[model samples]
Target: MSISFRVSNSSKFQVSEFILMGFPGIHRWQHWLSLPFALLYLLAIGANILILITICQDSTLQKPMYHFLGILSVVDMGLATTIMPRILAIFWFDAKVITLPECFAQIYAIHCFLGMESGIFLCMAFDRYVAICHPLRYPSVVTSALILKAILLMVLRNGLFVIPVPVLAAQRNYCSKNEIEHCLCSNLGVTSLACDDRRPNSICQLVLAWLGMGSDLSLIILSYTLILCSVFRLNSAEAATKALSTCSSHLILILFFYTVVVVVSVTHLAETQTTLIPVLLNVLHNIIPPALNPMVYALRTKELRAGFRKVLRLGLKNK
Candidate 1:
């Protein structure tokens, strides 16, 4: 199969070992462009980490809902660390070369974190559902034991299901093509390098993608439906509006995430589309939402806004 190139290299265009077209091949302007991304990555990590700390230390945040929020922060940090450090390395140094094993490792992280994030969203949805639907029982329903079980289940579900895809992709024999046309080592770019039939791996990705994302989406939808039905029963329009406003934020975030998720899913199934398109889509999926996460919650939640004020005051006094 032939491919296109943006680089000026001639002989090595098709048969290159693996030219990772990360940073969109902007060799010169990349250094400058990457500065903003680097700052954003740092900001995302720091914001999430701080939020996690505040959630843990603050007595008001001791509830299971906040437990999920803290967990979400940790996972956000994990996911960002998994990819962005390598991304930074790529920008600072010229070490875009990822060995076969390293490539597999990256894919494993991408899969695992993707699954975990989905699980966290599922947990958050369930949390919202309980709080809205059965406000009286929200505390008891999301008990410590049950939360433990839910986390365990999410871990097992994600780990067991997505592991095989990378393993399968790793086992495939790459004839000569090794160029990953993206910033990070992804399942598709790796699978595309294989010389032999990759239909199985492709199918595995589709299935897992459907199961992981689709399942999360279905659960979220179900929860929201229940929530919508229950919320309308409340007598206070102000209360209903407040609750709807919160749901609206999550809905917007889910919509943003699904835009990339569905687009990439369709791109994979299309088989004729440019891999670059998906690579960019995947990058947006992995980065933009995360960068906005803290901002979203902060702008919406009164406590976080207050916490930010307190923290800023403390920092100023310290200075």
Candidate 2:
């Protein structure tokens, strides 16, 4: 990677771009390591696109739940796209240099999409909650207008909340080395390189993360708890089984999503000496969930499975 030197205001040289070391200790094997990451990234993009297409073309999927699923696919694609390409470049071609603007954009985008995903998960949980817990009110409670409002809220909320993170990072003085330790331009990774104290950035990020994804996760737990209570209260065993089955796929998706998130958060907070594990886990957290979401839904949800089959048959017949 070539470095273009620029002068900072303090007669010190500012770093115009940053070098992203793919993995700290495993740089020699990056070419070999890129294979699985590449596959997972492609799977994430392809699967989410497939889901989006199926959801858009199928009229029967116009319900609130499907609306949120479509939004989730979009968010998943955004999250995967935000960091995976640069990671692939760093791994495959030694294209590790990222400009200041590019770094900031990645930080903003990754955080925005993450916040949106958490919000989408919460919305889906609420959808299931209303569907099972308040069957009679489900139609009125969850509507197209409501879904639209929720989408708008998510976009505005996350977009506004994350704008500061990149802005704060951009304002700092970068008189030192410009090499970021991680594969992507994470907020902490980028900001930590600044010459100034990074505590404000860290504290702001910690607070916003809790206010955003943390709160979403907490509400999701509550929603599911209510759902379980409603399911158990059903007088008939078959009805309870049906209700639980409806949420099983969603529960699995949520479990893996939050598990990876929690693990990654803990690792970051712990500030362990071994950074590779957390970095790799973060990459998997972004890529694996998007790839797995469509499969989980298709295999577990009857309607989505039928929708996928119909869409596939239509495409093949057209071909």
Candidate 3:
């Protein structure tokens, strides 16, 4: 893919496509690895779809929280779909060639969805904070308009900031290697192959990551802290328990998602380019949360489970 940009006009070398090595050290085990990953991808897609359908069908769930949950399902599906198919192709069929444009698109979608997921988490945190802290004002404060605006902001924040990551990478002079050792088109992995200095790409990615996901996580922590304070001050033990229970699923999702994110971030920062640990962590980060999120919500939230059951019953009756 020859990008005829002003800066790279004099560059003699250009890579048309990239060869993904797909776990360089584990070539023998890739077939076995594909089985579990494929299963996880299917579960992620299926569960999120089921959640979306239930939320849309159940009138009682037409509240602000459920609306956010529905948006989350869509994001989860996008997140999983962004990289899993290519990964499966690499593992199953040894189909690892990705054109430059396709790789750039994958990079953009992955980071955008990740940033949006962070935003959704923050929005869900705010929802819980208001519901628990100001029950009286919840109806007024967390309105449909508010949800729409939050989603719009979420999309813009990630969509715009993430563009630079892929753009910076794509603008680089790939005069050397055109092979990536990772399963997906990770920014760092792709940029490392460029003949030019990757400092700009690195700096851009680091700054945007902290500015987007870092801020969202910090605010989520603040919201939860305030919610905890309010819960403890409650007069009745049962009420406190109920408030905590309501946040249990969201908390679990937060814990798992951020934990993997932190590990991956640390590995990237440590510049552990020689090991497969970071690659594996990135795969887990992309796959596990989407698969687990809906299950957590369905099992923890009585309303969602009931909604699912009702949807199932209605479907059966119609048959």
Candidate 2 deviant stretches above 4 angstroms: 1-4, 272-274
Clashes of each: 0, 0, 1
Residue-by-residue lDDT tens digits, candidate 2, 1-319: 5556799777878888988887778888767878888888888889889888999999988788888888898888888888888888887778888889988998999889988988999999999999998999999989888998999999999999999899989888887678777899888888778888888898889899899989999999999999998888889999999999989999999999888888988898897443788888887888888889888998998999889989999999999
lDDT of each: 0.75, 0.87, 0.91
| Stretch of 10 with least lDDT, candidate 1 | 6-15
The digit string of per-residue lDDT tens for model 3 on 71-141 reads 99899999999999999998888898888999999999999999999999999999999999999999999
- Give me the runs in candidate 1 sitting further than 4 Å from their true place: 1-19, 23-28, 271-275, 315-319
Ranked by lDDT, top first: 3, 2, 1
Cα deviation in Å at residue 74, candidate 1? 1.1
Quote model 1's TM-score: 0.88
Per-residue lDDT tens digits for candidate 1, residues 1-319, read 2433322233233332355657544556565657877887888788897787677556666777668767777777777777877777777785677666777877888788778888888888888898888889977898999889998998888888888887998667665656566778878777877777989998888888888888899988899999999889989999999878766656766777777788877776685644556666777677766777777878777776677676667768999
Q: State the displacement of the C-alpha of residue 142, model 3, in Å, after optimal TM-score superposition.
A: 0.5
Q: Per-residue lDDT for 290 in model 2?
A: 83
